[model samples]
Target chain A: MKKYKILANEIIEFIIEKNLKRGYKLPKVNEFQQTFGYGKSTVLQALTLLDQQGIIYKVQGSGVFVRRNPGDLKEYVALTENLGFYSNNQNVKTRVLKLEELRLPPKWAVEKGLPASPCYSVKRIRIKEDGPFVIEHSYYSQQSVPYLSREIVEGSIFSYIRQALGKDIRFSEKYMHVVKLTDEQAEFLQLEENDPALEIKEVFSLSDGQIFDVSRLVYNYKNSKFFSQSSDEILS
Target chain B: MKKYKILANEIIEFIIEKNLKRGYKLPKVNEFQQTFGYGKSTVLQALTLLDQQGIIYKVQGSGVFVRRNPGDLKEYVALTENLGFYSNNQNVKTRVLKLEELRLPPKWAVEKGLPASPCYSVKRIRIKEDGPFVIEHSYYSQQSVPYLSREIVEGSIFSYIRQALGKDIRFSEKYMHVVKLTDEQAEFLQLEENDPALEIKEVFSLSDGQIFDVSRLVYNYKNSKFFSQSSDEILS
Candidate 1:
């Protein structure tokens, strides 16, 4: 990481540690220089980076102030990562609606990279404190996963895949569509049919480049927010 | 880039070059190995990557076949990238609705990183051959932009900023929300009031870390699809 980015992260930690609220004045640049022992330019760059990210703001001739508290904003689902319900939601629980072992993987599953052999198909509703936030229909290749149980499904399957099975998920490809909820989906999310929602189809590959999982996630339109940040490398 | 990724890109180019149609059979793995002079494993890896991305599908005994032709699927607005309508739409044109200079920037604009001095505010409706696709409300810091014109706004402002002003846009941060369109927004998008849409708020920074632009975009609910892809590094 760049020196300025390291300092920016430290500043964020300090803000969280001090429980700074919005509009609370921060220490001056020289004051931070004395504390962190960084040069003036480095400190300024760090602050500028933070300001650009909406973490803090500067007033002319005045010192910096907090724009928002850390964690005050709603968490956004990073589009590039695998779906992990545990990381974002508090007091979350899973209700497994269906878990079946298929003798011959369905045509859709095969097209999604599941082999023609046996596999596990799961339908789950992820509930937060307020209500069901997502409905997921997932297919796991038995060739790679080899095992599935209701107890594991209720918890974190990704964790089980990593810790218990010793598999590392390397990357994911996702396609998203803006869709209206069907009656069954609406009933699952406790929303009305025809309500707009986001449907994400995802494929997961393991470290060895083995495609082992495919999932379709439908998020509750009212409760979900997504965020993305891109650098020059991503520009067309 | 890795050798396999390079090969995958080459394969994509080959697909386009051959004008491969849906269900058209591609050259066998050996043929690709002969053409690219890569090892069998490398060729397989490239094919696997393409399969994971929904570009091709392999039959058990039959050779690989094209699942969809190049550009067959509707283009998805990559969540991590800026809103570049030109890249995705055909015959896209911009209709400048409002453009003016503000002596004292709005409070919301200031909060979004525009300096308190003079700036340009613009409202534009982007139309495609079908109809209006997006409505954008944007604020550009006069300190960075320096000047603006209706002719420029009717074209690509970002292109003008890069090509004419020689200012490099280094990065952007985006926040997305699922929203119901207001009556005014509905009229602009030619949709009914309360229609679901994606609202994206974005802040763009220059190479030197100056936040020069902030924009709010409302995408037509019926015509928009967004995509995101992440690696292990982006996992929470």
Candidate 2:
């Protein structure tokens, strides 16, 4: 292996092992060269190589720091167990568009195990600072678990269900499809009607296999990205 | 749980255990009723629920069939071990955009453990039957493994390496982000400039810890959806 390549690998291994988040400044060039006993050009080349990978950045006046874009598109694995829209990597905000009591259950309410009975229907728009990102239509079994207000809908529903309602988010089956946006959905997202969007539907069950909730999320194709990584899984 | 829900759960368990693929038709209504000894309403209600979840479909004047849509957008787990653009769910076509020799390796080539020298660079555009979808740029160490043709590139590179060249895929790491499309990328995809695009970067290593390959893929937002499900994991 080339000397500089070996040096680059060492630096990369260091960054990963350190578990450094973004904005972490690395040691100076001389410091790196002295510690690794590598020539100046070799160390410099290693740094340049890492920069090209978008792993770190070199400021004109300041030292090199880990590269972390504030507005970079993050993704959701869309796991049914993760029954909320929250990202510590970025600011996630939810707006309750419509909240009402459904006297007559929606025609397909039983899809998520909710019977033909009254339920709480909640509509929300999720934003991540850039703009409206996803519109969500969620249904909760009112008879089984009731007394949720609009305020609770604004925050993380998963946390609320677990911490407040004492419900367990066991697992879910999810289906994903791409479709043209409807007029109402487009208006909520301020996009052209019939524009492409990605839809994900999930039916979640509690520990005892009782229906907990059912939701369909429509993501604006313009700025949304979904990501997932696992040893045995497929992307999307 | 309601009687129909119990029926639905039993049907779901059967699907998973049977390992039914897309387009695998289920039993007829009378068949289901006789097999489970359930009433007509109970069986019909369970079918209705599965239809809502996009699992099955009814053919008028005929029996029900398993659901499969050709244009359904699919996602990747973005694992480096995935190593190719092939998907078992659909017919994926690859068109080589550019293939060249890197006289001077890209600065980040070594970051993926490639030596600081010449390498084979590949660019490809992947399309499903619906439309053009993802653009990929990949690099491999020329000396470590040589002799790749356009035909091999069109198909699965991982398959060729493992079956033809006798190499083992050890593991891979991936990074994902969402960003505005570059003018050139948008033009290639026939999309609007600055449209949202999902980018995934992967670095792979062989079983011997040698650098296998590094690639970056960009996907058009219009007809793309990613999905991942497992027993133990949550949404990111």
Candidate 3:
């Protein structure tokens, strides 16, 4: 991640950690610079990025203030971010419905750039405060991932990939469409059959441009608002 | 618009005008340079931008090939773009449901940054080949737009704002969420009253960062797939 993005994420953590509310005044730019030990320009860039994301707003003469609380922001899925659900919803828990290793990858997985060799097929539901809002079916290339454990699936996979494996996802090809909920999906999401659900398909590649994971995420009909910028800059 | 974005839009138009198909071979870099009279770097940048948008793909040794037919792309709305619907679906037609000049704008308009003085309230349905798929309720700032006619509302408002008024939309703050269709919206979109509909709300600004337009668009549940890049780069 870039320095500005790192600083911006740190500031979000700070806001949430301090239980900041809307209109709550933040530290001065110089205070941020002194605390974070970043250059003045980098700190300003981080603030500007946050302002653009509607997280914090700057008044002409006044200092920066929170526009919305982080808890309120948990419902919005950042379209460009691959940080996983746990990053946004700290209270989110995972239920692994299916996890298996396969020698012959499925055709859909192969089509999404998964090697036709050993791979893992996983199905999981992300349980938030309300209920299970997201059902994620993922296929990971074993050659790239090497292994998978139930314990790891219960936590943030992206964070594990970045911190433990030292591999970072650089970019993704994503498509978002609406689909009527199936009986099975409805049962899982606690929605009526044929309810409209937002389905997002993503193919993730590592920084070295190697395809590693392909995931199809189906969100509950309600609480499925996603956010992305018209600019190509990554939100985080 | 930037030179590369302009070229990219032109390339998309050329692909559509020529009725290009998936796997179709596009002109070489030198051919584009000669035809468009742009520097090689600018031309390459445009192609790279398109490649990132999944419009075209390049093989190591082989030349560029169309990844998908432009006609097949109409269903995906570019989230980062403020170009309006007509740019994507040229065959789309508009039916004016309501067009009026208002002294005191609605609360929604004011909340979205509309001036309280005078503005234009526009309600229209966009009819595509399939059926009426989008209901647009827009509020335009009269101070910035000056004037609007039913004829302009029947066509592309954004294009008029750019070409006729000499003002271009620079950026927008957009939110996408799902809503249960109301009786009126369902009748206009030909969906059930409680069917899921995708709603997009955007506040558009001019090049000088002045807000000029605020629009709430409701799309038919069947054809509301929008596209956007996670990267900060604008996908033309």
Candidate 4:
């Protein structure tokens, strides 16, 4: 068991020694195991740990690659396409909070860069996969999304917006920050007071530059992760 | 002072009562003071408080309004946008870790859904408006972004990429969760041992469906707030 960890560290050391660049592919897992004379499970465990450390990444059909420099503390993701689709088959538990139609005042208009219009508001909790992931609050412009109803919002709001309102979310500007969980947040997420969480704020804009929506996403960080790919300078 | 709070609450109440949606302009500051028989300072203080609560927003030349809700807590931008950009500008400070190009292993490739190719990586700490906003670690495909150097990463990595690589960021798929701060993370962010913080994982993709970047953004949420907007049904 210890040998496998040593082997994994050795692999990392080799990469560092060679000054290998990012995206450099590694040998096959079978080969690695064979070379190290380690069991598949041992190799897998070590690899998994390294992945968690943001050291390496695995490509499905392909092999693995060195992801970052040695002693790098930043987190990285290898894949980031085909997202934003909701699954109807999966059963996700939810708890609803405030839901209503709200008119935009000057304050909101300025924030959203909208021309001061009426909007809809919805707040809910979502639980899926490992645990409760996030508390979501959403707002929509009434003029843009006419005839929004409680029933429509009951299912997948993203689907409804796409199907009924014909709104296509092209891009979003996102801001991530850390926040101490409030009593309500902690209770809802089933954590103690002051448990840290990630707060994701985004503004969705259409391809034509119209600000369509804005939202705040709060998540439990212990069981979650984020992924992305960018140039070295961008990452710096 | 009590009257000021009352007047501010009254303004919010009026918006809700009248169903004034987002972007609905409020009366002028002078008008508010006259109507409520309050001093300008009092009225301004109340407005400022409301603004801070995100109950209202303001435009420089335009008046204030009740804030319109934007949907998708994970994608909302109102709170941070108003706070100001987290920049490495004069007011912001940055602590650079190590910067270098390195090869990613198969584990990272699989996570990124890549083909186990060579890649470049950079790591750094971003500090400016507040405490450490994020410790960024990034990985890039060498095939796409060649000629990346450590010197280039010391400044704004995003700017370097756009200027040097001509790569434009179109969208990103993000994952977020909460975690207790590790001794290292806590020390770096200047928090107590085991302080809770928000962790965000993301995969940034380009317009042509190319996976370009991945990052994990951690935020210190001790004194901060996070919010998201989504349809009510998603809560279920």
Candidate 5:
């Protein structure tokens, strides 16, 4: 993880450890700089990223404060396209359900421009906030990362790809659909078969246009909504 | 509606009328200019908007083509934040459910920074492809729009406000949530009570920050998903 990310996590822990409530003021940059021993720029960057994630809101001229309703549906989805496979998907536990190396690509992978031959698959059931949250099936290009381990999958794969393999993710494209859960998925999620679910297919690529992974993610839909923006929003 | 929007709608109708399939190349720019009496710039802008809306896609070498499934889940949620009050909420028919002026405001209005003076309410049921698609309830600022009729609500109130009242819609703020249906909403949508649904609360403000409208929108959740972009996507 990046230094800023580590600091961000520490700040989150601090807030939780202190039981910070809405409108509770967080320490200013100088104070954070002294406390965390991070540079001024690192503290500022961490604060900005935290604000963007809706963890704390900056009230300009006044100070930064803990945002009310961190779990509010609206705040949760503010930049929804980037949800899942990130810090927000944090949980107490993750169970590895399947791992395999395959030569035949699924139809969706072929459609997403994944080349055939030499692919690794990873399936995971993530428990978020102590509840069944997401079931993900992901296929990776073996040529890119080349190796995987249960230990690495237990942590952030993106971090290992960046730190170990020295790869940087450029961007991701995703398509979402409302679907009925299959019997197996229902059992995993502890929901009834055919219950409504949100399905997302995402293609992650490196900055060099190397397709790294294609994933199918299914989220428990009853408590979730997505947030996204249009490029044409007029600024006032 | 703008001329580009009208032209875009005409193109949509053309595709549906002819049952254009995926990879079906649309007419070139000159052809659209000749057929629709549009200028080069107008044709280009309209095509760009259509492409952005996912009604059509541009191929680098071949030409512009009607996307395989313009009715796909992704397309429906493109630019979804400004739905109901705009032309993109296209359909076969719309049924006016209720319209009235009220002196008192809902608690949410004061919460949204709306004035407490008189306001008008409009309820509508929109049908797309011969099915109930959207139910919207809007509260208008009496000072901004003092007069409205069933006829105007039957069409786009934004049009009436723009063409008739000469008011321009600058931008809007929307909050989305997955909510269950109330009895009245269930009856209006003809769905079972407590069924999962997507709900949105929107505040439409003028460029000068005067809020002209507030809306609560509900969508039948069985087949719908939202599509949006993140402003921070690191373009490679």
Candidate 6:
């Protein structure tokens, strides 16, 4: 076999030429190392890199195997960077079921550090291609956006708040967890009873650290994926 | 009634005093305005400010309500900062289940841009206050960490790699989603079959962008939470 540096590429070509699909088990490492006349470390280095790229996965006690078709790599990359990628992929659409302004209660008022009177809330559903992906519940401080309406939410709410209102948004805090679908949420998302949904809760803040919006996005994971970035220090 | 500012604070104090909880509906805007003797807009402004702080949530067709337990404020704040407050708060204990070096297959080698040989795999279980919280499966490039051993992984694998090996880990790409537990994972996590779990798949990279590690973190959502930060521009 070629030297260690080129061995990884050669193996990839073999998989492509052989048409090995996802979940296809590979030959044992000892055999490959002997055939390639390379140290075990060299071979492992190559495999580890591939795994990081999302091309393969390892099942403990089982063995390393090829990953299933990852769909489109470009689309996946785009989805991570731009929400517009949803529309570009032609597989997801935003449907504004309802949008309105309403007051929040005293308890919530205190938690958000508002004057503790009333607040405004916006609700919408996101469709995946032709199917449903998530139901979104968003609450915004009217003081942050004085005049909100259904027409403004029809498109992208983020765009409207920034461009139209001239609100300089800065940073936000986000939380993700899993939750059993409420009966109402299940009905809205067409999920079965007891099915778990991924919940993304976010608090939007301004440059001055004034938080003005909190949103709960619940997604049916049977047809979706979420991605993020982290520092490697956490692993160490 | 006091002016709008103090009225807002009073509203907040009232919520706290009454010990309101999440999902507990609040009074309507008109009711609040009349009771507080303030302009409708002033009351709305106070509610709006509170919403921005993530203290309250609003539901259309319903009313404003607390979103999370008031007692969880400190934990919530730390979580938003990615401080692992929940794990720390619960004082979770980690146990090394298995750590070993194995040969990687050709497919994995190709995906990671490695030479298609052997790699190292580390597996462990993390418990929260003695109960299982998560199971972690990590794979490392043999070349990057050739001397990895079971003993080294016993403590914190992340700490060892950075301190001992002096590997310069920089950034990582992570994919988060939900998955139904398999029979084995369920048994390890001591949960029922098809129980939902939070799944995080990550790829670690060096400063130069070389792939160094791939890890999958599976957590019992009943006992854990995931938090992150983003720009408000994305939300607005």
Please give the lDDT score at residue A225 for candidate 1.
79
Q: Write the per-residue lDDT of candidate 6 for residues A61-165, one digit (tens) a residue.
A: 777776533442323412222233343355556778766666767687777644223456778887766478778888777777777777776667777777898
TM-score of chain A of 6: 0.58
Off by over 4 Å in 4: A1-90, A104-116, A206-209, A231-236, B1-177, B198-236
Tens digit per residue, CA lDDT, model 5, B1-236: 67887887788778877888655889999999999898988899888767645456665566887653444442355433454323344443679999998776568657754534578888888766636766888889898889999898988887788789876565455666555578988887778786667677776754333568888878876545555433222211
TM-scores, chain A, per candidate:
0.70, 0.62, 0.74, 0.59, 0.63, 0.58
Task: Report lDDT (CA) for all predictions.
Answer: 0.76, 0.66, 0.76, 0.59, 0.67, 0.63
Error of 1 at A26 (Å): 14
Clash pairs detected, candidate 5? none
| lDDT by residue (tens digit), candidate 5, A24-134 | 888989999999999999998888767545466565487877653343332254443433435444443678898888776568557755533477788988776647777
**iRMSD for every model:** 6.5, 10.8, 6.0, 12.3, 6.2, 9.5
lDDT of 3 by residue, B1-236 (tens): 68988898899889888889755889999999999889899999999878656577665577887755667667677775556666677788899999998786467555755644488889999988889878999888887898999999998888888889987566566678877788988888988887887788876766544567878888886866766544322211
Selected candidate, larger TM-score, 1 vs 2: 1
State the fnat of candidate 2 relative to the true structure.
Answer: 0.15
* TM-score between model 5 and native: 0.64
Please report the TM-score between candidate 3 and the true structure. 0.77
Model 3 clash pairs?
A230-B80, A231-B232, A232-B231, A232-B232, A232-B233, A233-B231, A233-B232, A233-B233, B77-B227
The TM-score ranking, best first, is 3, 1, 5, 6, 2, 4
Compose the digit string of candidate 1's lDDT tens values, residues B66-107. Answer: 654546444666664554656556577899999999776467
1 against 2, candidate with superior lDDT: 1
Better of 1 and 6 by lDDT: 1
Chain B superposition TM-score per model? 0.69, 0.62, 0.75, 0.57, 0.64, 0.59
- Report the Cα RMSD per candidate: 8.1, 14.6, 5.6, 18.8, 8.5, 16.8
TM-scores of the candidates in the order shown? 0.72, 0.58, 0.77, 0.46, 0.64, 0.62
Task: State the lDDT of candidate 3 residue by residue for A44-81, as single tens digits.
Answer: 99997786555776665777887656666576877755
